[model samples]
Every structure is written in C-alpha cells, then in structure tokens.
Target: MQTVANFTPNSIVGEIEKVLDTYPYNPYQQAFSIPDIRQQLIEYVLVRIPCADSSCSVESSQENTNQVPVSKIPRTPLQHQLHLQNLIHQGICVIMQMKSELISQILCETVQPVCEPSHWFG
Candidate 1:
C-alpha cells in the first residue's frame, strides 16, 4: 500500500481515501477500484458555488461584514426573511400544482376506459 505522504490528490485512489475519512464506516470494508471509487466519491461530495456579489472573493472575504460593500446590495433582516418566505411559498405552490396535475392526469387515464359515461366525466 502507498503511504499517505506519497499520495497525491490527483489520483482517484487518494481522493477515495479522503472521501472515506468523512464517513464513519471502515474505509477498507470493500475492495475499491480506483476509477469506481473516484466516480462515487465525486458524485457524493457537494460543489461550492461563489456568492452572487461580483466583487466578493471566497478566500479573502470575512464571514460577516459590518457594512455591505459598495458593489453588493444590502437588505434588512425583515426584508431578507420576507424574500426567502415568498420564494419558498412560490416554489412549494409550483411543486404542488405540478404534482396535482400529474395525479389528475393518471386518475383520468385509469378511469377513462372503466367509466360508463366518458363524455360526462370529460
């Protein structure tokens, strides 16, 4: 087995070992081929996206700024909360509407042939 110090992050085996460390299960439980292990690990790990502010740098920015930068748009706590609530409400409404329409379509198809009066149901 290659030593950790000798391992480079570029190789799939090394990446798999790093990912395995994040989980509680024994890393050696199953024999893993480099490509499959790499693919699975990459799929599971979340990718970070940069914030919307064009001037913001992920590496240099502080966790929270005392004042918003000139390029960034600032919002009051209440405004931010309300914006989030509205977005969530709209998303839920869209999802529920789609689900209801799909269910209605399936019910219509299943009942169409069995109904004695298709024209009345339609």
Candidate 2:
C-alpha cells in the first residue's frame, strides 16, 4: 500500500528482488505460492483489538501473547477505531512489501528477453 509518492520505481524493484530471494531457488517451487502472510496481519489485529478493549478483565500486566476473546472485552468506539487504524497500517506495510517484490521479479524477467540476446550478437 505504499503510495507512488513514498516509493521510487527502483526502490520498489529492489524490494521485490529481496522478497523473491528469500525463497529457495528450486524451479519447482513457485514463488507465487507465497506462504500465508495474511496470518501475520490477522495475529497483529487480534493482539491489538484485545489490548485496546478497555473492558477486558485481564490486567494490562498480562502478556499480549495470550489468546483472548473479543466478546470477553467491551471496546469503546474510539478504541476500536484506533486499533483499526493500527491494523490497517500494518496490513499496508505487509502488502506493499509483497507487491514490490513481485513487481521486481516480473520486471527482471520481462527485460531479460530484450537485454540478453544483444550480448550474443555483439
């Protein structure tokens, strides 16, 4: 979700390469089969929602790692909005990183057809 204003094309392309490089280089392993990154975003939302809800009996001292029910806590409108914004920001970061990496790979692959043959000709 990074805006065009925030990211130059070159930097976005670099990010794309970095993400692709994270995977093993096996031809059989499709890079598009990227593991479920959404789960991390879900976990972030889960943690923030419960923490924001003021009605939860669990003291703030309790660690966020515990799984708590949303129904167990009453969340104020403002609290919910704040947590929602936080979650949105986190989701955007994850998505933008993924997108940048995919675009980089596509650009590199596409350009290969044009740049590679000329080397042999010369």
Best by lDDT: 2
What total of clashing residue pairs does each candidate reach? 0, 1
Candidate 1, after superposition: displacement of residue 13 in Å? 34
TM-scores across all candidates?
0.26, 0.31
Instruction: Give the TM-score (vs. native) of candidate 2.
Output: 0.31
lDDT of 1 by residue, 1-122 (tens): 11111112233234345544544432221312235433433333211111322223222244456533323322344543343334333433443354455545544564576636568667
lDDT of 2 by residue, 49-108 (tens): 443323334443435657354444435555544445545466546554656666467546
lDDT of 2: 0.44
Clashing pairs in 2: 16-101
Return the lDDT, model 1, position 116.
61
